[model samples]
Target: MLTFSIFAVLIGLLAINVPVVAAIGLTSVIFFALLGQGSFLAMLPHRMYFGTTGFTLLAIPFFILAGNLMNTGGITRRIFRFAGAMVGHIPGGLGQVNIVASVIFSGMSGSAVADAAGLGQIEHKAMVDDGYDPVVSASLVAASSVIGPVIPPSIPFVLYGAITGVSVARLFMAGFLPGIIMSLGMMAALAVLAKRRNYPCSACRTPAREAWASFRGAFWALMAPVIIIGGIMTGFFTPTEASVAVCIYAAILGFAYRDLKLRDLPGILFASLHQSVSLLFIIAAANFFGWLIIHQKIPDKIIAGLVALGASQAHVLLIMMAVVLLLGCFIEGNAIFLITLPIFMPVAKIFGIDLINFGVVMTLLIMIGNLTPPVGMCLFAVDSYAKVGILPLSREVLPYLAVIFAVTLLIAFVPGIALFLPRLVMGGM
Candidate 1:
């Protein structure tokens, strides 16, 4: 009961629009007082500092910088153009292009907001100019952006692995098949919608020269994910090292493409800094909060309660997913992982669930929240990029959202959908 009440208080603080840092830190402080452990207050400062000192966490800022750099540079446009040449001949022309572009960008950015806001402006204008509905364009972009974190080189996977001690390499490999499933699923749905809505399609194949030109144009930009993931898989770089390398690579591409100027770098650096600071602060505060939760053995009590309900491994997972899905709608995605994983992990152990599969499924569920209502970040990004109303985008996004959620649940139950590649290459299940 005390454990659950801490959730209520923390959530209540968040619901009232408290800063995440303050809300989490305050929750920990308040709980310590209530528990009559006033001395814990003295430990808060050190604990917060301690949490931020991990070397692995250096990946977060560099990845954010890489995403912002790619978004600002010419890379997004080239990637989109490459995707269009490959897939624009499909029914619903640019809709398929949109998904393909997002899939490719996902491998690099690993962030839904970057995909929506970066490629979004170009995708919307192309689709709308080519006579697609604003609602459809906005919604498709929002739905497809969910793929950003599910693919390799995912930032969310990094956060998950960091929090849970799972192998980040395995997590990256785990994303391959699930990412393909998401792409094929959305593209299939777009095909049906194209026919039903009579979306324009290119009547002839893209010229061989044009296709080759696009692939060549995007070759370096495309190589970002390949180099990063390849380096990690081959043990040449840790995830943190990969982030720094990608940042340098992204800057080179920016300059080489001639779209980014020396003067523009300050703005990109400031944006990345601002974003990274807020994220890292939440991580620190949440770490302090989580330490208190563990110290209190709240997870144990929660696990006992669930077991008392006779929940099996699958049932506990389903219950946790439902909780995460609900929480994702209200909270930021990484914060959702930071807050919930401490509780859910112990429950997972008691139920004999595998951590890698759990990481993949949990990351998917959190990203899905970015496509949902009210606070869905990608929805807002798409709306701002296209000026389409959120309500309509929300409605049109339903089919893709439903399909991906079902696919996520499918992965959760099967495990092999995610674990297969990791097992095949890394030799562990």
Candidate 2:
């Protein structure tokens, strides 16, 4: 009953537009008070600190800084131009470029909002200028932005690693194939839609020289992922070290490209700092809430209830996928991950689920949430950046959402879709 009441308060607070951290914190406090464990409030600060203090968590800020520097240093534009040269003559033209660019930017950013807000501006403008409706342009940007977290160097993957003690390297490898599948799926969907709608293709195939030049211009930006992944896989650096390395690499490229200056450093640092603080706070608050859930044996109850219902592994996974997707429409992806992962991880293990595959599917579903309506971060980011209204943008995003759902289910049913690369690279699941 206490658990139910706490959840009720959480839902009510979210509905009223309360900040996620505050809502989670408030709910946890009230739950403890109602249970006569008011002394738990004294430990709140320690929980928050412990939650955010993991060495893995250090990578969060460095990656954020690296992504911001890359964006400010003209990395996104070079990647955009290169993608356009490579795919601009395809059926969807600029829409294809949007997906391709997002796939590449995902390497650097590891954030859907960064891809949506940063590369999104470039992609949305190009599409609109080429006669696409503003809504469609924004919709495509939001959809493709989901690719950001599924690729290597993902922030959510990092968080999952920190929380579950899962190998982040394996998680990184697991995302590779699934991310490619999603990218291709979106492009395929775009092609069909483009052909149906008579969307314009590029005026001409990009000349070989132009394509080479674009790639050359984006060379440093292009290598960010390779170096980060390679360094981690080869034991040259930890994920945290790789993040710092990427930060330095990005700063060097920023100066070399002349896109980011000394004056820009303060702004970039402040922006990264602001983002990092917001994310860390959510982790802290959710940690407190998660502690209460664990203390109350919530996951055990859930596992027991599922088993009592004779739920099979597939049934559990599908139900979880649906619940996470619905939750995503209401809460930010990171918050969902932090709040629900503790509750679900134990049940997942009982069903003999592979955490690597589970993490990929979970991350993808939560990312799709970002593209969803109401509180979707990516949706709002694109809308704010592109002035694409919510209703029209949501309507246009449906087909892409379907494509993602299809790919997600494919991955869920065939765990190999996510695990093959990780098994091959790491030599085990």
Candidate 3:
């Protein structure tokens, strides 16, 4: 009853336009006061601190900083040129380039907003100039940005690993194949849309010489992922170290390309700091809210409730996925992850489910949430940067959402879709 009441308050607050961080924080305090445990309020600061202090959490800000650097340093433009040279002749033209560029950017940034704000602007502008419809172009950029987290170097995966004791490296490995599948699926969907809508396409694929030239220009930018993932695979660097290394690498590329300047450093750092603080603040607040949930025995009651209902593992997972998807339409993805993991992780373990498989699926679901409406972060980011209106952007994103949603179900039901690389190299479930 207390758990239900707490959520009721949270939902009510959100419906009234209360900020997520404040809503989560206030709900906890309000509930404690009502329950005559106001004294526990003193521990809120400690819970928030502990929640944000994990070693893995260190990567979050660095990854965000790397993304902002990549954008300001012109890395995203080079990536756009390379992808356009490689795939611009496809039925979708720059639409194809949009997905391809996002796939590459995904490796570096580990952030949907970063992808949407940075590369998304370049892709959106290029497509619009190339005669692609503004709404369709913005929609594609918004949808493709979700791939950032589904691939390696994902912020949500980092948080999930810290919470569950799962290996972040293995989680990174599991994301590879699924991320490729998402790229291919979105490209296929775009192909049909492009052909049906008569969107522009080049006469033929870029000439080998031109492709080579673009690739040469983007060579160093392309290496960001290779170095990060290779270091992880070779055990030469932890994910945190990988993020730092990539930041330095992005800086070098920015200078070598002669696109970044010393004067840009301050703005870039301040921007990165602002974003990092925003994300970390949410993490801190959600931690407090999550602690309240755990303290209330919500996980135990949820497990016992499912057992009493004679729910199978599949049923339990389905119910959880459904809730995540529903809430995703309104809540931010990271907050959803923090809030639900305490409840879902326990239920998952009780049913003998694999945490790696669960984490990948959960991350994918969170990615989908970012593309959803009412509060989908990627949609708003794309719209803000591209000046695409929400109503049309929301409408146009539906087909791609279907594609990603299908892939999410595939990963959920066919665990091997995610676990193959992890099991192959790491040699464990």
Candidate 4:
């Protein structure tokens, strides 16, 4: 009854458009009060503190700042140049470049919305001027940007590590193969679509010399990911320390290239702080709500119910993936992560599933959510920049979405696709 009441109130608040953080907190308070556990109120402040005070979470803000600095410093353009040299001769030249740029930039930033906001403008404009549909161009950018979180140094993996007690380094390594698969999957989809439409290829097929020259210009930017993942795997630095390294690398590239100015620092700092605070607040509230579930033994009950139903591990994961996909249409990705991870992690462990593989699945699902309607951050970012509406963008994204979903299912069933790199590089997970 108490569990039902809590979920009832949570659903009611969400239906009325209350912010997720506030809804979670208020529902938690109501649940505790109903139980007459007044002392539970005291736990709120501590939970809030612990949620945001982690050393690993410190990487989020630093990485955000570094991404902004890199954007200001002309890193995006250099990466685009390299991508163009490599893939611009393909049908739908600029569209293919968008995918290539996303794969390359995902290695650097690890945030989808940041990728969309940073790269959407140039890619969209180039495609439109080159005779592609604006909506199609915008949709492609939005879809490709989802790659950012699946790559190494991923913000989602860091959050998963913090919440699930999994190894962040292993999760980072685990992400590599799946990320490449997503990139390839999207590229394949784009190729078919481009061929059907007979889209134009680049007039100048960039020679190997030009391609190498473009790569040289972006060499430092390319090395950022290696330094980050390599350092973490080598035990040279923690994730937090890798963030500092990213900042230092971005700073040197910005100043030496004379792209990011001293004046830009304040704005970059403000943006990072704003994003970090919003994310941390949601996490804190979710933690409070998570505590309520623990106090009420909700996860245990749910697990017992599933066991009684004789659901296999695969069946349980299928249900979870369906729920995540449905919720992704309505809620923001980060909010879904904070609210669902705690609920799902316990049940998943009961089936003896590996947490690292689960982390990869969760990251992929949330990223797919970022391309869905109403609250898809990547969708909104690209829409705003390209002046395209959601409905049209959604229609344009359907085939690409189908391709992504197929890859997601493969990753779900084949744990090695997600776990192999991590195990190989980290000497077993």
What local lDDT does model 4 show for residue 343? 78
Deviation from native of the Cα of residue 210 in model 1, angstroms: 1.3
Q: How many backbone clashes does candidate 3 have?
A: 0
* Local distance difference test values of all predictions, in order: 0.88, 0.91, 0.90, 0.85
Model 3 spans with C-alpha error above 4 angstroms:
none
Q: On residues 1-429, what C-alpha lDDT tens digit does candidate 2 reach at each position? A: 655677789989999999999999999998899889999999999999999999999999998998888889888899999999999999999999999999998887788888888889999999999999899899999999999999988999999999899999899889989999999999999999999999988878999999999989988889999999999888899888888999999999989999889999999999999999999999999999999999999989888889999999999999889889988989998999998898889999999899989999999899889878798898888888788689899899999999888989999999987888877877855
Model 3, residue 288: what's the lDDT? 88
Model 3 TM-score, all chains together: 0.98
TM-score, each model? 0.97, 0.98, 0.98, 0.97
lDDT of 1 by residue, 259-355 (tens): 9899999999999999889888998898988899899998999888887889888788888999999987878888898898888889898898989
True-structure lDDT of candidate 1: 0.88
Error of 3 at 160 (Å): 1.2
Sort by lDDT, top down from the best: 2, 3, 1, 4
Backbone atom clashes (below 3 Å) for every candidate: 0, 0, 0, 0
**Which is the winner by lDDT between candidate 3 and candidate 4?**
3
lDDT of 3 by residue, 1-429 (tens): 877888889989998999999998999999888889899999999999998899998999999999999999989999999999989988999999999999999999999889999999999999889998899999999999999998998988888988777899999999988999989999999999988899998989899999999999999999999999999998999999998999999999999888999999999999999988998898899888888888878999988989999999999989999989988988999888877888899899999778998888888888888887889999889988778788888899999999998998899899988899988887856
Q: What is the lDDT of residue 3 in candidate 2?
A: 54
Looking at model 3, the pairs that clash are: none
